[model samples]
Target: MSEKRRNRRIKNRNINQSEKSTISKRSKIIWIGIIVISVLLFSSLLSLQFLEHFIIVD
Candidate 1:
């Protein structure tokens, strides 16, 4: 094996690792955003129900 071939292989391996980590981080961020949105939506719904049950609107 030559030095150039060895270097190319190492470079390719590093790039693959970088791509995998980038994908993982992006997915984590997406999941966090979804969870936050869901919490906010549920809380708003609960508040609306509470108001309807306890108060009257004219």
Candidate 2:
């Protein structure tokens, strides 16, 4: 691989995961937004699967 790719691989390999889960103050809002969107998406899928009534046009 090229030097850039090798450096990226090394950097990724050296990731300090101890602090990865600790969300920053600013990122907390973004995390909440992400969670809300994920929940909405999951609920929409569930509604489509089991709740929403659809008419089949044959």
Candidate 3:
């Protein structure tokens, strides 16, 4: 019975560790995606402003 309890505790600890790693990985992916999207949006806005200036000058 003590052996079984020990095994259970080890399994639970491993599971918790894996879960923490997965959560961190997921958050990292999400942050990367958000950064990419924001950069794209900023570039597009800059391009639009440049085009508008050109149109006004012409």
Candidate 3 residue runs with Cα over 4 Å from true position: none
lDDT of 3 at 34: 100
- Residues 23-52 of candidate 1: C-alpha lDDT, one tens digit per residue: 999999999999999999999999999899
Score candidate 2 by TM-score against the native.
0.46
- Per-prediction TM-score to the true structure, in the order listed: 0.84, 0.46, 0.88
Q: Report the lDDT of model 2 for residue 56.
A: 36
By the TM-score metric, which is better: model 2 or model 3?
A: 3
lDDT of 2 by residue, 1-58 (tens): 6999999987886674435645465589898999999999999998886644553331
- Give the lDDT of residue 42 in candidate 2: 97
- What pairs collide in candidate 3? none
Worst 10 residues of 1 by lDDT: 49-58
Worst 10 contiguous positions by lDDT, candidate 2: 49-58
Model 1 whole-model lDDT (C-alpha atoms): 0.96
Clashing pairs in 2: none
